[model samples]
Target: MGRAGHRTALMVAACAALLLAGCTGAQGTNGPELTNTSPVPVSPGSEADPTSSPSSGESDEDGDDEAGDDAPEPSASATETESGPAFPADTKPDTAEPTGEGETFLSVTDVRVAAHDGYDRVVFDLDGTGSGKPGWRVEYVDQATDDGSGDAVRVDGDAILRVSLSGTAIPTDSGVEEFSGDRIEPADTESIDEIVYRYWFEGYTTAFIGVDDAERPFRVFLLEDPMRVVVDVRH
Candidate 1:
């Protein structure tokens, strides 16, 4: 062969050897060879999918951001409402004597009436420079009469209950303001019809409680710490 042809043949032989070396390396490997492939980076010790749900530790950390997640809800009926006293069976009258001194200088300051579930309550609040508590005399009467003028007072209802407060004094003597309101007719009461208050006369404060039909069971008691007289009448 000529010199140029010999040189061309050598170049062709070298190129065939390089091609065979590359194809042998690729075919001899355990896995198929890939072209222009990029390897994905993974964390050091992680086993879960990256695009899937978070791990347990990561989920708990997210839950910490939300407050009161595991706390119990408050109950709707945790507190109970208070109820009034029961109705009395006795129909007799009640009375109590004064405490401390013979003639207390107490003056009637206010009068309040409220109805309960089974009875009606009337409170006579007293305040003054008295030495002790006040006394009371309560009973059923055929007619209500005024102590100052011996004249009969017109009262409503079929039965009349006379409430006489002893050891009382006039507004001038007690150094306290007397109740200025006249009649009180409670709308929520079941038995009591009306209350007519008379002025204090001669160390006694007299009042009339008009009741429905016949006389019912009644109870009278006195209390201290801003003195008061309480009357409970059954329906």
Candidate 2:
């Protein structure tokens, strides 16, 4: 009994030693050691390579640029102005020949005077069986006189401008109603004082314009619808 028991104990002891050696080897050398921390995972398309080239349309030193920053601004002179047609005017005596056919039989039918923004206007309307507009001559005079009789004509003003018209006839010969006033005085006048109208005699007619100022600047022009002779006197 004693020998068998001893032999059994020896076998059990050897078995226990083998089991201990197997566990020590597994912990120290065979497999890697485990921990509570897990390995970090990589994100898709998130990281860039350090050696790669930069993308297009990006500034290296400066930030994003604004469009048209260096362009010049619009100038004030570029803007346009609204104005009427130019009317050339002067103070010198003016004369013009008859237009269209040389022969004419125009008679003064009406007279109009008005005050404007910078001037006073005197218009003489004429109508008859004429083929052309009447010619005229305007000049400053010391004293007004009748063209037919050479008689002194009384006019009231500081200065007088004589307006003589050609290519004209009397009302009876032209078959047109003529203006029937010896003098014309208008209200709200800026430069004019009065006008002395002499009836047509022969082929010419004469008139005197009394002005407020001596030798004021004036302009003469012709207009057509019904044919008119216009005088503009600056204040």
Candidate 3:
């Protein structure tokens, strides 16, 4: 206690045993022993705020680039509305030219005429028996008789020109039989305008002449055969 106070108490006991051996090796390499009655608290960036984040990988790459740019704008708006309208993929329709004058009493096959938008049709292809001799009769005489072209034949306006008889004198009491002769009035004489009488009891007998205004022009006649006639005129 007197060698310089025992050498300053042996250098303060060797610096308090080297500071308690460096606080017991820093609490055994930084694990347990933080005692204020340890409760659970080591919040230093709380585990890097949930798994090594860079804002969660930039929010998952902006949700996969907004789902790949909204998936090609509905397939490019369905490929620009998938085109449209352009008809003519093998088109076909046009045939009707023959207007009056005798000598064509039947013998026609497959003739078609179609004009649209305001109605225009003519189709004929007929040849042969439609009944027994004198089984079909059509007469609208108000005057015109030399087989036609004398003026006085009207239909649709009811001047009385209507006849559709088929087979064996067609009169099973009365299905069709009409003839006008009030002098056959309504005469602008374009040959009455419209008439269609298709008969089939044996083979054929078709007569269709419709024209009310499609630039009027129509005529057909194929008669001569114990009186087998087919006259259609509209002009």
Candidate 4:
């Protein structure tokens, strides 16, 4: 071979070697290695950093929360109750009647009580004439007392109804022996807690009617012929 041919061959060999070395520095189909220096683009939906938190996205409707779908719903409001009995509610006191006032003395013979619909009745029967209107005062109070001695009468119930009859007395050998029985009687009555025969003092006899409740309604009236004082108390 000639010297010119050998020099040309040597230049061509050096050019080929330089081209191969340049191609080796760039990435190829074999993918990037640890030593790669090119900027790596972040792909969509791909995790940028292996140790970083995940991104927040729109959740599906069927997914459950930490409390879960088994949690109960909040409750509603409460309810009320029914009302009370329906009846007349009069509690006024009355003076004596003009029809039956002819006897010298009005004798209290019996004190009776009976239960009725929505009310309890107290009947005071006198053995003498009731021409004079028997004056009476009846009202509920916090305390009960004796009409003569002024001692506190221990009444059992929510309230004590004081019944004062102005023109009745009992005839007894021992200074008018009052009617004999329990001064306080509720053994057979409904709304009445007791029927206490208090005392007869100065032509005025006072008794106590113990009731079951405080807000009950009551009324007072008089009956003819037999001379009876009628007291009606609501349940």
Candidate 5:
């Protein structure tokens, strides 16, 4: 062969070799071929089963129901707890019932008025057991009668008053004399004519009298618990 023809043939052989090398490089760079071992089984009617799987934002509603069942019940109020056996709200209790009893019980048992020496002597009987202490007052009342003509023997605002005490077993004259003022004297000596009124303490009982005038329409109350006497003078 001539030199030019031989060179051209050699160039064609080199070109064919280069083309084969490029094809092999492309196959190697594309990565490995995969093989299938088993087929993935598809479930039938899975979409129709409500409990099969939870959706993206869903939670178990049964947990919420259990929490509601476990919650504690509410408590009652204090008013409801104290509701039974109470006194009626609007009623006032009666005050005349005997708060204390016995011979020495110094409750005001009775009262009477008598005219003596131009003075009205209002007497009281202390029926309870008490030694009448100093905190006693002789209040008086004065009002004209309906006729308004004759002088009504109403309890004068200014009246002489005295207090004494007696029982089946009489209290001492000295005890009765102790309560009288300089102007007033004991009613001319006697045993308890009536239960004028009685008030008692640890070792003493007292009866009361008006040296002057006691306000009329009078009521007497003995507060024995605290040892007090309230003489109400009404018109």
Candidate 6:
């Protein structure tokens, strides 16, 4: 062969060997191989959808805020109202106390009269050794009368309220009159005019309450602790 031809053939052989070496690695792979272990970073515009639903933890916080804004306040309706007690108006009512049906010594201590919104109240305080209330019957009479002799007792106002108590007497077992105050208590106010102290005889006593109204409705009741009889007259 000629010299130039020989040189051209050698160059072509060397180029082919280099190409074959590049095609295989040390483990004898067929083509170029990649062992990329690092993760590829994404661009800003290629991030997740901006309008998508949030994660569970973030979603719960957002939902709570929305629900709180929509929550309702307490109701002020009248249907959910408080209840109260009912009391009687005028006329005779059930006996308020156990003031009668027993035999015991009762003495008068003090008498007080006061005017109220719906009625005029008269309180008769009784002092006794035993634990018993004085039984009384209060009725409207033309005139009050003195005990035993039945003499007419003059009291102020047009109507007289006779109070006859059963379970008590003025003088105790020691024969001492516990009450020394005046029998006629002047109360020139409201329906009541005067309070009269009647006589005590045979384990019994009588008194009078003078009110201005003749046809007024009245209620009688008894109190404890200090034992007193209360008369309420509707104005």
Which candidate number maximizes lDDT?
1
**RMSD (Å) of each candidate, 1 decimal:** 12.3, 18.0, 19.4, 22.3, 24.2, 15.6
Worst 10 residues of 1 by lDDT: 76-85
Regions more than 4 Å wrong, model 4: 1-103, 170-178
Candidate 3: the clashing residue pairs are 104-222, 105-222, 105-223, 106-222, 129-203, 135-169, 160-180
* lDDT to native, each model: 0.79, 0.77, 0.35, 0.66, 0.37, 0.64
The superposed Cα distance between candidate 4 and the true structure at residue 181, in angstroms, equals 2.3
What TM-score, over all chains together, does every model reach? Answer: 0.61, 0.61, 0.20, 0.54, 0.20, 0.54
Instruction: For model 6, name the residue pairs that clash.
Output: 99-135, 106-168
Task: Specify the highest-TM-score model's number.
Answer: 1
Compute the lDDT of residue 141 as modeled in candidate 1.
90
Scored by lDDT, model 6 comes in at 0.64
**What tens-digit string does per-residue lDDT give for candidate 3 at 1-235?**
5789999999999999999988887778664566586666455545545544334335463476356666755443211222222222221221223222132223332233333222232333233333223223333323222122333333343322323223222222223332211221223334344443333333223233333433233222223332223333232
Model 1 CA deviation exceeding 4 Å by range: 1-89
Task: Supply the global lDDT for candidate 3.
Answer: 0.35
Q: State the lDDT at 46 in candidate 3.
A: 55
**Residue 119 in candidate 6 has what lDDT?**
67
lDDT of 1 by residue, 57-175 (tens): 56443576345667787654211112223435765566777776644689899888888667777888899885788989998898999996789998888899899998888888789
lDDT score, candidate 3, position 134: 23
Q: Which 10 consecutive positions of candidate 3 have the poorest summed lDDT?
A: 77-86
**Which lDDT tens digits does candidate 5 get at residues 77-170?**
3222212232233312212333322333243333444333322233333333344332333322233221223333332223322232322122
Cα error, candidate 1, residue 51 (Å): 52
